[model samples]
Target: MGSILIKDTTREERERIVRESLGDGFDVTCGYDDAGIDYQQYIDGKKELRELNAEADCGFVVAHPEEQQKGCNNI
Candidate 1:
Protein backbone atom coordinates (compact mmCIF):
# COMPACT_ATOMS: atom_id res chain seq x y z
CA MET A 1 0.00 0.00 0.00
CA GLY A 2 1.11 3.53 -0.70
CA SER A 3 -0.22 6.92 0.33
CA ILE A 4 0.39 10.54 -0.52
CA LEU A 5 -0.34 13.78 1.27
CA ILE A 6 -2.57 16.18 -0.60
CA LYS A 7 -2.80 19.76 0.58
CA ASP A 8 -5.40 22.06 -0.95
CA THR A 9 -6.26 19.37 -3.47
CA THR A 10 -9.48 18.20 -5.10
CA ARG A 11 -11.09 14.79 -4.65
CA GLU A 12 -10.73 13.93 -8.32
CA GLU A 13 -6.99 14.48 -8.17
CA ARG A 14 -6.68 12.28 -5.12
CA GLU A 15 -8.77 9.53 -6.71
CA ARG A 16 -6.70 9.65 -9.86
CA ILE A 17 -3.46 9.41 -7.96
CA VAL A 18 -4.76 6.47 -5.94
CA ARG A 19 -5.96 4.64 -9.03
CA GLU A 20 -2.69 5.13 -10.82
CA SER A 21 -0.61 4.07 -7.85
CA LEU A 22 -2.67 0.96 -7.13
CA GLY A 23 -2.94 -0.03 -10.75
CA ASP A 24 -5.90 -2.07 -12.10
CA GLY A 25 -6.16 -4.91 -9.62
CA PHE A 26 -6.38 -3.18 -6.29
CA ASP A 27 -9.21 -2.09 -4.06
CA VAL A 28 -8.92 1.50 -2.88
CA THR A 29 -9.82 2.61 0.59
CA CYS A 30 -10.07 6.35 1.09
CA GLY A 31 -9.85 7.94 4.51
CA TYR A 32 -10.41 11.58 5.38
CA ASP A 33 -11.02 13.75 8.43
CA ASP A 34 -14.43 15.01 9.39
CA ALA A 35 -13.16 18.42 10.56
CA GLY A 36 -15.05 17.97 13.89
CA ILE A 37 -18.49 17.73 12.34
CA ASP A 38 -21.09 15.17 13.38
CA TYR A 39 -20.15 11.92 11.65
CA GLN A 40 -23.60 10.32 11.47
CA GLN A 41 -25.23 13.52 10.39
CA TYR A 42 -22.66 14.06 7.70
CA ILE A 43 -23.10 10.49 6.51
CA ASP A 44 -26.85 10.83 6.41
CA GLY A 45 -26.54 14.10 4.53
CA LYS A 46 -24.17 12.50 2.08
CA LYS A 47 -26.52 9.58 1.59
CA GLU A 48 -29.35 11.96 0.83
CA LEU A 49 -27.19 13.90 -1.58
CA ARG A 50 -26.08 10.72 -3.31
CA GLU A 51 -29.64 9.49 -3.53
CA LEU A 52 -30.52 12.70 -5.31
CA ASN A 53 -27.76 12.08 -7.82
CA ALA A 54 -27.86 8.26 -7.90
CA GLU A 55 -24.39 8.07 -6.41
CA ALA A 56 -23.01 5.87 -3.64
CA ASP A 57 -20.45 5.72 -0.83
CA CYS A 58 -20.13 9.44 -0.15
CA GLY A 59 -18.80 10.76 3.17
CA PHE A 60 -15.73 12.42 4.71
CA VAL A 61 -13.76 12.90 7.92
CA VAL A 62 -10.99 15.15 9.22
CA ALA A 63 -7.83 13.03 9.24
CA HIS A 64 -5.06 13.75 11.70
CA PRO A 65 -1.85 14.63 9.94
CA GLU A 66 0.07 12.63 12.51
CA GLU A 67 -2.00 9.55 11.84
CA GLN A 68 -1.46 9.96 8.13
CA GLN A 69 2.25 10.29 8.78
CA LYS A 70 2.16 7.04 10.74
CA GLY A 71 0.34 5.36 7.88
CA CYS A 72 3.02 6.55 5.48
CA ASN A 73 5.68 5.24 7.85
CA ASN A 74 4.03 1.82 7.83
CA ILE A 75 4.05 1.80 4.07
Candidate 2:
Protein backbone atom coordinates (compact mmCIF):
# COMPACT_ATOMS: atom_id res chain seq x y z
CA MET A 1 0.00 0.00 0.00
CA GLY A 2 2.77 2.38 0.93
CA SER A 3 5.86 3.13 -1.06
CA ILE A 4 8.16 0.10 -1.50
CA LEU A 5 11.01 2.16 -2.87
CA ILE A 6 14.34 1.44 -1.23
CA LYS A 7 14.62 5.02 0.04
CA ASP A 8 11.11 4.92 1.41
CA THR A 9 11.37 1.66 3.32
CA THR A 10 13.53 0.42 6.10
CA ARG A 11 15.50 -2.81 5.80
CA GLU A 12 12.96 -4.54 8.04
CA GLU A 13 10.02 -3.42 5.90
CA ARG A 14 11.73 -4.65 2.77
CA GLU A 15 12.36 -8.04 4.36
CA ARG A 16 8.74 -8.30 5.47
CA ILE A 17 7.47 -7.34 2.01
CA VAL A 18 9.57 -9.99 0.26
CA ARG A 19 8.70 -12.63 2.85
CA GLU A 20 4.96 -11.95 2.66
CA SER A 21 4.97 -11.97 -1.13
CA LEU A 22 6.68 -15.37 -1.12
CA GLY A 23 4.09 -16.90 1.24
CA ASP A 24 5.02 -20.42 2.45
CA GLY A 25 8.17 -20.53 0.32
CA PHE A 26 9.88 -18.48 3.01
CA ASP A 27 10.62 -19.41 6.61
CA VAL A 28 10.99 -16.74 9.25
CA THR A 29 13.20 -19.05 11.30
CA CYS A 30 15.24 -20.65 8.51
CA GLY A 31 15.30 -17.75 6.00
CA TYR A 32 14.79 -17.63 2.26
CA ASP A 33 13.82 -20.52 0.04
CA ASP A 34 15.79 -21.34 -3.11
CA ALA A 35 13.26 -19.38 -5.14
CA GLY A 36 13.10 -16.70 -2.51
CA ILE A 37 16.85 -16.12 -2.55
CA ASP A 38 16.58 -13.92 -5.64
CA TYR A 39 14.95 -11.25 -3.55
CA GLN A 40 18.17 -10.68 -1.65
CA GLN A 41 18.97 -7.76 -3.93
CA TYR A 42 15.69 -6.14 -3.04
CA ILE A 43 16.23 -6.74 0.67
CA ASP A 44 19.67 -5.18 0.43
CA GLY A 45 18.30 -2.22 -1.58
CA LYS A 46 20.68 -2.97 -4.43
CA LYS A 47 17.67 -3.42 -6.70
CA GLU A 48 13.92 -2.99 -6.60
CA LEU A 49 11.31 -5.76 -6.73
CA ARG A 50 10.28 -4.60 -10.19
CA GLU A 51 13.82 -5.07 -11.50
CA LEU A 52 13.95 -8.57 -10.06
CA ASN A 53 10.55 -9.45 -11.44
CA ALA A 54 11.59 -8.19 -14.86
CA GLU A 55 14.67 -10.38 -14.81
CA ALA A 56 12.52 -13.38 -13.93
CA ASP A 57 10.14 -12.64 -16.78
CA CYS A 58 13.00 -12.32 -19.25
CA GLY A 59 14.39 -15.76 -18.37
CA PHE A 60 14.70 -18.12 -21.32
CA VAL A 61 16.64 -21.23 -22.07
CA VAL A 62 19.62 -20.83 -24.33
CA ALA A 63 20.17 -23.39 -27.07
CA HIS A 64 22.74 -25.98 -26.07
CA PRO A 65 23.22 -28.67 -28.68
CA GLU A 66 25.65 -30.55 -26.47
CA GLU A 67 22.96 -31.30 -23.91
CA GLN A 68 20.18 -33.80 -24.47
CA GLN A 69 17.64 -31.23 -23.34
CA LYS A 70 17.32 -28.21 -25.61
CA GLY A 71 15.65 -24.80 -25.70
CA CYS A 72 12.89 -24.20 -23.13
CA ASN A 73 13.21 -27.75 -21.80
CA ASN A 74 16.59 -26.77 -20.39
CA ILE A 75 14.74 -24.73 -17.80
Candidate 3:
Protein backbone atom coordinates (compact mmCIF):
# COMPACT_ATOMS: atom_id res chain seq x y z
CA MET A 1 0.00 0.00 0.00
CA GLY A 2 1.21 3.54 -0.76
CA SER A 3 0.03 7.14 -0.97
CA ILE A 4 -0.49 9.51 -3.89
CA LEU A 5 0.45 13.15 -3.52
CA ILE A 6 -1.42 15.87 -5.43
CA LYS A 7 -0.56 19.55 -5.24
CA ASP A 8 -0.99 22.90 -7.02
CA THR A 9 -4.56 22.14 -8.12
CA THR A 10 -8.09 23.49 -7.66
CA ARG A 11 -11.01 22.01 -5.68
CA GLU A 12 -12.67 20.77 -8.87
CA GLU A 13 -9.45 19.06 -9.85
CA ARG A 14 -8.96 17.70 -6.38
CA GLU A 15 -12.49 16.35 -6.35
CA ARG A 16 -11.86 14.65 -9.65
CA ILE A 17 -8.68 13.09 -8.33
CA VAL A 18 -10.44 11.93 -5.22
CA ARG A 19 -13.13 10.35 -7.36
CA GLU A 20 -10.59 8.50 -9.44
CA SER A 21 -8.29 7.79 -6.51
CA LEU A 22 -10.82 5.25 -5.30
CA GLY A 23 -12.11 2.10 -7.00
CA ASP A 24 -13.57 -1.26 -6.18
CA GLY A 25 -11.63 -2.79 -3.27
CA PHE A 26 -9.10 0.06 -3.53
CA ASP A 27 -8.57 2.37 -0.59
CA VAL A 28 -6.95 5.80 -0.87
CA THR A 29 -6.91 8.89 1.32
CA CYS A 30 -6.32 12.42 0.03
CA GLY A 31 -6.30 15.99 1.31
CA TYR A 32 -4.80 19.41 0.62
CA ASP A 33 -3.99 22.62 2.47
CA ASP A 34 -5.72 25.95 2.02
CA ALA A 35 -3.25 28.59 3.16
CA GLY A 36 -2.84 27.25 6.73
CA ILE A 37 -6.10 25.29 7.06
CA ASP A 38 -5.69 21.62 6.31
CA TYR A 39 -8.28 20.09 3.91
CA GLN A 40 -8.07 16.36 4.57
CA GLN A 41 -10.69 16.70 7.26
CA TYR A 42 -12.80 18.83 4.99
CA ILE A 43 -12.63 16.79 1.81
CA ASP A 44 -15.05 13.98 0.77
CA GLY A 45 -18.05 15.94 2.00
CA LYS A 46 -16.83 15.92 5.56
CA LYS A 47 -16.78 19.70 5.32
CA GLU A 48 -17.73 22.37 2.86
CA LEU A 49 -15.79 25.14 1.22
CA ARG A 50 -17.36 28.40 2.37
CA GLU A 51 -14.81 30.82 1.02
CA LEU A 52 -12.20 30.47 -1.66
CA ASN A 53 -8.79 31.63 -0.60
CA ALA A 54 -6.46 32.90 -3.27
CA GLU A 55 -3.42 32.10 -1.13
CA ALA A 56 -4.25 28.43 -1.13
CA ASP A 57 -2.05 26.33 -3.42
CA CYS A 58 -2.17 22.88 -1.91
CA GLY A 59 -0.17 23.88 1.17
CA PHE A 60 -0.96 20.71 3.09
CA VAL A 61 1.25 18.34 1.19
CA VAL A 62 2.22 14.75 1.91
CA ALA A 63 5.30 14.07 -0.22
CA HIS A 64 7.77 16.80 -0.98
CA PRO A 65 8.36 18.25 -4.45
CA GLU A 66 11.81 16.67 -4.36
CA GLU A 67 10.79 13.53 -2.55
CA GLN A 68 12.50 10.38 -3.74
CA GLN A 69 10.78 7.08 -4.34
CA LYS A 70 12.05 4.26 -2.15
CA GLY A 71 10.50 1.34 -3.98
CA CYS A 72 11.07 -1.88 -2.05
CA ASN A 73 10.38 -4.12 -5.01
CA ASN A 74 13.59 -5.47 -6.48
CA ILE A 75 14.07 -6.35 -10.08
Per-model TM-score, in order, reads: 0.30, 0.60, 0.25
- If the candidates were sorted by their TM-score against the true structure, best first, what order would they fall in? 2, 1, 3
What does candidate 1's lDDT look like per residue over 30-67, in tens digits?
A: 32222222222223223222132232233644477555
Q: What's the distance in Å from true for residue 26, model 1?
A: 1.4
How many steric overlaps are in each model, in order? 6, 0, 0
Query: Model 2 off-target regions past 4 Å?
Result: 24-37, 57-75
Off by over 4 Å in 3: 1-7, 24-75
Candidate 1: list runs displaced more than 4 Å.
1-5, 30-75
**Model 2 worst lDDT run, 10 consecutive residues:** 28-37
Per-model lDDT: 0.37, 0.70, 0.42
Model 3: what TM-score? 0.25
Please provide, for model 2 over 9-65, each residue's C-alpha lDDT reduced to its tens digit, 9 standing for 90 to 100. Answer: 998999899788878667544534443436778888898877666556343454775
Provide the global lDDT of candidate 2 against the true structure. Answer: 0.70
Instruction: Tell me the RMSD of model 2 versus the true structure.
Output: 7.5
* Native-to-model Cα distance after best TM-score fit, residue 73 in candidate 1, in Å: 7.1
